[model samples]
Target: MAGTVAATLLVVVAAYRFRSSRQDRSLPARAALPGNVNQQLSGYTFTRSEGGRRIFTVRAVRTVALKQGGTTELEDVVVDVFGREGDRHDVLRTGLAEYNPQSGNFSSRGSVEIELNADPPPGGSNGRQPAYLETSNVTFRQQGSLVVSDAPVRFRAGPVSGSALGMTYATKDGWVELEKDVRVELQPAAQNVTLAAHDPKSTIPFKATAGPGLEAGVVWLTAQRLRYDKDSREVALRGPVELTQGNRRIVAGRGTVFLDSRNRLTEMLLEDGVHGFETTDNSSMSSAERAALRASPSSEPALAHSTQSGPPAHGTESVPWLPGSEVQRERGPLPEALEASAQRARGIFDPASGQLRKLVAEGGFQADSRRGGGDRKQPSVSRLEAEQFEMTFEGVHSEPRSGVASGNVRLSVNSSATSVAPKAVRGGRPPEAKTARATVKVQPATQTETMTAAEMTFDFRAVGRSLKRAQTVGAGKL
Candidate 1:
């Protein structure tokens, strides 16, 4: 039903447009605009062309310019054109290839140049939006739609801006196609992210077709031969998108990226390609930082499921009863150096709990300490090293909200230290003992006081829409 109504409207509008043939334009090729146009400006049309071959016709309004000794000048502005005419024939509106002194450079070669400049009407009621000259090469065929631009064309809109290497406009479909190489460099504004490019063409995105009455305030970008639905708040790079922040840059094969009003990337979708990894050598981030960088969530930090060794592999086990409540060890006690070193090695921690969302680092899987027989006056500790360590953290919100979070850490490393210090009798000097450096290494020969986790993850409800679960396994030396 909608299609039928649209077809009917097109036919009705097309018919009404051709009702009157006001005049004709016989513009001869010349070096400058013909000084006299009252006799030449009469070609005014309420219609497109007779057959759908003609793209547009100009109706020049006569005026006198204050410049050039105050001479009467002819402003040949093309008010309107038939969109269908160009589409049906694949006609391209292009500019002068090489200047020809004999005739005005365009139309004679089947190329057209359109320019328009009119003052805003009183009370800002002018129907004229802004306009610029369009120039390109075109080849129109009945069976095949017209394609413009055998070469790069340019748009000299004004002194500060220009667009080049444009595309085609089909009168039959009323579609203005922008080429893939199209680039546009906008002047920097208070908040606008400016650009620079070549052979750029643009159109309102197709998403609007899904809406009612097509809301305004849209600048559709077609680049790399892809369409984008963009707005002031966010610029969605629908196809492969890339953003260059100060020290971080993200490029996605396919995803929607959310940026702040300042054009900072907030989050994006990071998918593994055929090889399971995407290589990036961003110019912004330092080598160390780029290597350590992880994928930004589609949202924020949320606790994952209840975890045993780490965040559960891929299930609801990541989420605990409460979220974001973490259990951290109280750093204290011991021989000053031993205590500090033990704090570094870790000996005790609250075990994993389903009720408590926890993130912690474990120094060893097992730690045994024996009380002295009383004959011995000193407390003693033995050090054992393990190759690999595990850490876990989870989110549990009694607040009725939680998500995957960098959880509690459970890590163990190999270490060595002085065995025992001999004590002296009260008021007497103690026996002197020689000391050697204590050395320890974890079990698998892969552990250290500082263990680099393969990955740390949390499970949380994300974007308040669905679940957000993350797990990072092996990354660096642990």
Candidate 2:
């Protein structure tokens, strides 16, 4: 988008100079030619200056008059726009270009290439590349400050790259719209590259990552259309937007991303039926390995299950869950995977660290998770549903520390149980079970628990790599 903006600036400069040269006599004089034959000139140069500083320069190797219409054709044209502070060097190059002062129209006959923020620092690019754009058949309507291209366009800016069927830029309104079949790719790196008229100091250091489990992979985005607002520094996508990184995926009807002046990602919002899935590195851990880890001497004591009639205490009872924690410690900590759906979803990020700070979901929000390595037939499941849900994260690992759910919140947990007998009985009292690995004494059955409340706050504690306990609030009941 920044590259397109540079191209728009170039067009505006060229169009103004063309009109100025035709009417104003102060510009360099054109070569004299026969009245009957078409006029021709070589080595054309034009410069626009402001406050004793050169703002831009336009140069062409050859210029010819078109006989049919009052149009001028320029060959091997180059347009350079030096930013106001003299810190930016943007250039536009085209094999041939045409301008008509009478119609207020400007266009390129051949492929156009644009380089934005091409000025490297004192030490050079340092293995990095500047923002670049390639497109053909571009037209500018000078009267409207609009630039449009019917042909396909491709661009690369820092760690971002993409292509689109067509594009339009409204210079006056400070916006750019990519017309159809928009596809964007993000590479994981420290993106400090300068863009457009924004200064180098304004460029934020951004490290791209899809999510916790997808840190090593690149992110991909596909949408039918995309729009960028310069003033707001927002990118909006329409028509079933999908973003993916490795095994993690998010889909939505529409999405928007906000960035600060330094190009730091601040927030992302998705609306109209949003769905997401996340998996951790432990997703592939084997049941035996998980159980071994939990059984290690250094691990905390496992929560014991009750075969008695009464349900477990609120928030304190161990809920045998899956994909993250097991129904039984002997079954192992569940491989971490999360699935969520909502009418809308929003993500907030820390501008300085480029890490996710919080996540929010609202309107028919539901989340389901299960631990792996349990009984194949009846796996443990944990689910939470609410009108709205919000989660906060902490540390460099992006660990989720707490969450809140409001408006008819419900939490359900179901687990499979194996009846076990104690190794010894105590003086006429029922046999006491010591460990989850006790001898089987009765039939296997399913255990289920449900909690409901108007609002619920969960304070999460980490037990090794698994979620241990959640303290609920707002009069939640079992």
Candidate 3:
């Protein structure tokens, strides 16, 4: 009787273990498998969480229906797992897909869809919201590769989608890699924008690519860097910021575009660089900016306003857009006069026929009438370029209502004008005006029509209107 009872107890324990293990085992779902790991899974939801010392919870929900040889394997798989940090969540998720005893490695796919969510690892105070990653109908190609179309992907508040390819990512952790033929449209906070990054590396959770005539917001301004804040609805950028209105391209260094209540690229700020403006009326290249952006494109020494450099600039609440409301097909000095354009390796000898590029910037800037200007209603700045030359003011301006004029530029400078203040006298004794004078010399470059300024400060607030305002000037051989 004792032996029989012991045998019965063993049988009951075995039955319980088998039943529990069978119910808990998680298998990777596949859509269609040839002979390899060409696994395709969909309708799968995965969630992973890890906390101090011990990994707490992990779960996946998926349904797989596939054809192998001639048979179909369809199963509703739920995976509940535990990990010890030694193995990250992705490793586990990837391993689960590779658990097929028959297949060596997963390959190909009719379609693979996965959803992943990760909460802040639980160890300390957890009041912060976790980052969420969600994507659907993704046709996963290989382990780290997937091709999908019309599937929306988002991270914090940013989301982008539309016929995506060459996106290597792990849904388990929040990551989406974009490469080759990348066109993304971002509609964050205040503005709707599009970016065509030939090669873009983005970890932004949600990203969407919009199509043409989509009016993302403003027509669009470009540069090496363009960023927008979703919360504040602000956009900011540094380096070759260019605005395209119709066919004109306005270029600048650092600038901001403010979105109006109507969500438009409104006010602009072009800082630390000259603006290059281009006209749709490229009547043809009268003169091209023979700019050769060598491997080293260093900026001129910092002027008083040249402080922010070599660091990431945060977006401002609202700022002036550098190239705001660019003039369309307007006439100017040269048919090809532009804001700013890029220069390649070889230099340009004949811009009219040379490979010319320049950057143009046009935006409202404050002109101190009492000092910054002598009631000469200041116009917005337009800069052109050439080898060793940065030409400013594409054309003369029209008296603008903003006092901050737009159109072109106008200025008065003497070839050799001199100045002397009573303060400059050594012993507090007043010196004769003509004897204590200092001269301002303006020189022109050899190959370009630009007059290079040695960058001098003039208290010309009281100076006259013409080129010969105060002192007698000298003439240089041009």
Q: Say which candidate scores most in lDDT.
A: 2
The parts of candidate 2 lying over 4 Å away from their true place are 1-37, 43-61, 78-91, 115-131, 189-217, 281-336, 373-375, 395-397, 419-444, 459-465
Q: Of 1 and 2, which scores higher on TM-score?
A: 2
- Candidate 2 least-lDDT 10 residues: 296-305
Lowest lDDT sum, 10 consecutive residues, model 3, at 395-404
Give the per-residue lDDT of model 3 (tens digit) for 106-175: 3222233332222224643222222222334333332332323334443231222222234345332224
Scored by lDDT, model 2 comes in at 0.66
Per-residue C-alpha lDDT of model 2 across residues 2-99, encoded as one tens digit per residue: 99999999999999999987878766676666564376878778775668776557789998877657887888988775644444466678899886
Q: Quick one: best TM-score, which candidate?
A: 2
- Each candidate: RMSD to true structure? 22.5, 17.2, 19.3
Clashes of 3: 41
The ten-residue window of minimal lDDT in model 1 covers 334-343
Better of 2 and 3 by TM-score: 2
What's the best-to-worst order under lDDT?
Answer: 2, 3, 1
Identify the runs in model 1 with alpha carbons over 4 angstroms from their true place: 1-46, 49-135, 138-147, 153-166, 172-174, 182-223, 227-241, 254-478
Tens digit of lDDT per residue, candidate 1, span 64-141? Answer: 332333323224433344344332111123322221113322221334554322232233422322233355454433
Residue pairs with clashing backbones, model 2: 204-262, 320-327, 322-370, 322-371, 323-335, 323-370, 323-371, 323-372
